[model samples]
Target: MKERWVVVIGGGAAGMAAAVSAAEQARYLGVDCHITVIEKTHQVGSKIRISGGGKCNVTHVGTSAELLEKGFLRAAEQRFLRSALYAFSNNELRALLQQQGVATTEREDGKVFPVAGEASVVAEAFRTLLQRLKINCELHAPVQAIKVHGQQFHLITLHGDIVADAVIVATGGVSYRHTGTTGDGLRLARALGHTVVEPSAALSSIMVQPHSLVALAGAALRGVAAVARAGKLRAERQGDILFTHRGFSGPAMLSLSRDVANMQRSQREAVHLAADLYPQQLHDELEALLLQHSKKQGGQLVRKFLQVSPIGMLLLKSETMPYGTIPNAMVPLLMRQAALDDEVTFATLSREHRHQLVVTLKQFQLGTVHNVSLDAGEVSAGGVALSEVNPKSMESRLVPNLYFCGEVLDYVGEIGGYNLQAAFSTGWMAGKSAVNKLLTAL
Candidate 1:
């Protein structure tokens, strides 16, 4: 019998997992299988090397099928993921790292990271595992073309061409091209008759118009809520909002950006982002507090009380109020108004202050998104259309002996370890299914 062969393109998290899973499955079945991984970059797992800002958030703490199901975009995709996630939960992944000499620590938010605080450790674990399995790794061998021949795949690389019985396209999406995710997988899949969804940036920063209030850059307002509205539809997220020189970031802004991006794309209008700095407290509470404080410190300037929150200070400063002149009565009224209304209106800070306070605060809207820069993206949204692929095998319905895993497929998750989890899960299932199908054919 001819030796069974499987070729996995790309060597990021998905590719590594697929290659490893295929090799392991073949070993368990007592079948001779050659598993090869092709990476365009000099090193494998480049994206993993920089994931979580180098801390390498491997996976989230959610282990239940339902919670894990919430991570993917489609219901069927989530259902398909359950088996792989169960096979390798967060606990199991952590244990695997421990065995590889990399200890993991979980944050209060349930994000698991390596003790060394470097994504390279996670990459090392994958590399070590593949090495132990004797998987053939071809780094810097970027595939230029893929030709499907009857029951085999012919991959044309810069070095040369190689034929394999099965192929796994795990080349990821078009984010962080520097990390070797250049959307090659999507293109390759498309050439093979798979429908590729136009990719967009997910978990990315929003670019707001520059206002003098942008001076408040670097200030993070925690526990603040932001509502991104298109028309009747709105999405709200309450988290830390960080002001950046360009626009806004942090969890709140990142969460809002997704809806804003979608709205901007569909409506072709400026997306509205309203920030409620005090979401928990009611207008009456703020009004009462302000009234009490005003009476207690009748002589003290409002600016002094405003110093309690940097946002308050910015608001006062934007209104052109000198440090000592703002009245205590006005402070409470402003707070009350901000708390009561979903949108807080601010008077112009200056006749021509260059930063429109009202525009920056309440009407802080941004025009249609020109383009989401790939380099700044956390993950790429959209890939191979899920309808054309079988959820059970991650294999294309249009093609035989071909599979896709990771961001290369039309699967994306919100920030956290959701994307990584999906990649691991899909890769594992695809690997096992490919091996099973190959054996069945034999």
Candidate 2:
């Protein structure tokens, strides 16, 4: 009998998992199966090396289908993810890592990290697993074209032509192009009759214009709530917000970016983002405190009252106030109103420093984003439409024996470990299902 073969394109987390699962399944079936992982980059898991700022948040501890489902953009896509995520939850992946000599730790936010806290370690874990399974990995082999004939798929690569009974496209999205995720997989999938969602940067930082917030760059506000509004719909997230030289980043901004991207593309209108610097406090309580402080610091410049809020202090500037003096009585009223609604008058931000404060807080708004740079993003918002693929097997509905996993699909998740976990689960499902189908056919 001829040896069965499964080809996995792109050796990221998804491709690696798919190849391994298929190989393992074939082995159990007493069939000699050749598993080939073709990687465009010189090394597999190149994106893994830089993920989580090199910590490589491998997966999230929130294994509940509901929590994981919240991370995806589409309802059907979220439903499609249930089977795979439940099949291979965070605990299962952790155990797999431990078995491969990679110890992991969970952060307070439920994100799991390798003890080494280096993405390289996680990459090595996958590499070691593939090595042990004797999976054939052809690195630096970019697939230029994919041609389907009958039940087989032919990959025209930079090296040469390669054929397989089953093919899995896990080439990932356009984000972090330096990592080799340059949308090749989406192009290939499109050629094979799959609809490719025009990709946009997700889980990325935003760039705002004409602002001196650069002075406050690197300041981080925890439990900050960001709300993006597009017409009647609104999406919000409460997390840590980090000020960057270009614009805003950290979990809060990344979460909001998804909605910002969608609203920009769909509505053709500029999206508005409002941030609540203090989400935990009630508006009335905050107002009362501000009022009390105003009485205590009566006659003091309004800027002096802003010392109460962490975010307020960062926006204060000396030039905005001539004598740097403000009416103390106005402090409580402004603070209370600002807390209730992010929209505040310029005087409320800093009475003494009214001009700068108003510009910084009340009027501080960026355009609805012309585009998000993919090179700096953590993931892409869109990809091959989910309807064209089978959730059970991660196989293409139009092309038999063709499968896709990872960022290649129109599934994207927020910051944390949800995206990586999705990739692993989907890849595992695709591989196992393909193997099982092959066996049953034989």
Candidate 3:
């Protein structure tokens, strides 16, 4: 039998995983198969190196069900990702890293990171695995186009052309172009008769309309429920949120930015952001707390209870009910919004004043969203439409022997390690399916 070649484009998480899976499968099958990874940049795993502020959150620690519920919010995407996620799970990925001498630690929030605490360690582990597997990795080789010639795939690159029996397009999305992901895979998929979902920014800080909150830049609120509404479309997320000079960022804002971006595209209506400073407290419960506190500490200044330091407030749990805190800087802002004087005490508080205070705290407006930054996005949303690809194998339904995985696909997981996990699982499936297709043909 001839030495069949499998060429994988890009060297990010998905492409590297595909190459490794293909090589391992070929070795296990005792076939004379050669695997090649073509990366446009000089180094592989550029995204991994910068993810999680360089800590490289490897994967989230959870079962498939938990991951689906938390990471994938949409039913269609969850259904599509079920098989791949179950096949090559977070546990299996961690185990693979462990086998490559990369120890991992799970944080209290279920985020997994390298014990060494440097992203370079994780990237180096993949490089070491590739070396041990003896897979050929061609750096500085950017594929210009892929021309199909019957059973063979001719990949035209900047350096030269390489013919392969099968190809995996994991070139990723347009976010972080400096990392070498510049929508090459999306263009290729479109050229090959696949429907491409116009890519948008996901997990990016939102730029809000200029308002008083701009002065509170660097202030943050923990575990707040934020809701963004554009026209009739509404999206909500609960987590930590930071006040930026332009608008807001952090887990909650970043997660909901996807919907904001989509809404901007769908309609011309302005997007507005509102947050519940006390998400855990119901309106009636919070109102009662205010009333009860007034009776107990009638002499307490109104400013004293509402004030939070600029450093922000952490979660405070009492014996029965919990209290959520807002930024100290927000105290004056909220007081102004409620038309209350800072010198006023609970003893002098009127019925209307108390009601207004509660209402202002519950629905604090963060202003309108002006834009979602694609360049600043952690990952790009939208890609090759899921309908054109097979989830079980990560193979293209329209083009045999062609496959896709990672950010190039339309599915976008929430903040955490879900996106990386999806990349690995789908990449593994694609690689295995390509090998199977070749073996059956022979």
- Sort all candidates by lDDT, best to worst: 3, 2, 1
Off by over 4 Å in 3: 308-324
Which regions of candidate 2 are displaced past 4 Å?
66-70, 230-233, 280-302, 310-371
- What is the C-alpha local distance difference test score of each model? 0.73, 0.77, 0.87
Instruction: Quote the RMSD, in angstroms, for model 2.
Output: 6.6
Q: Model 2, range 76-150, lDDT digits (tens) per residue?
A: 777888888887778888898999889999988778899987899989889888999999999999999999888
Ranked by TM-score from best down, the candidates are 3, 2, 1
Query: Residue 365's C-alpha lDDT in candidate 3?
Result: 81
What lDDT does candidate 3 reach at residue 396?
91
Candidates in order, TM-scores: namely: 0.83, 0.85, 0.95
For residue 364, model 2's alpha carbon misses the true position, in angstroms, by 6.6
- Candidate 1 overall lDDT versus native: 0.73
* Candidate 2 TM-score, C-alpha based: 0.85
Candidate 1, residue 254: Cα displacement in angstroms equals 2.0
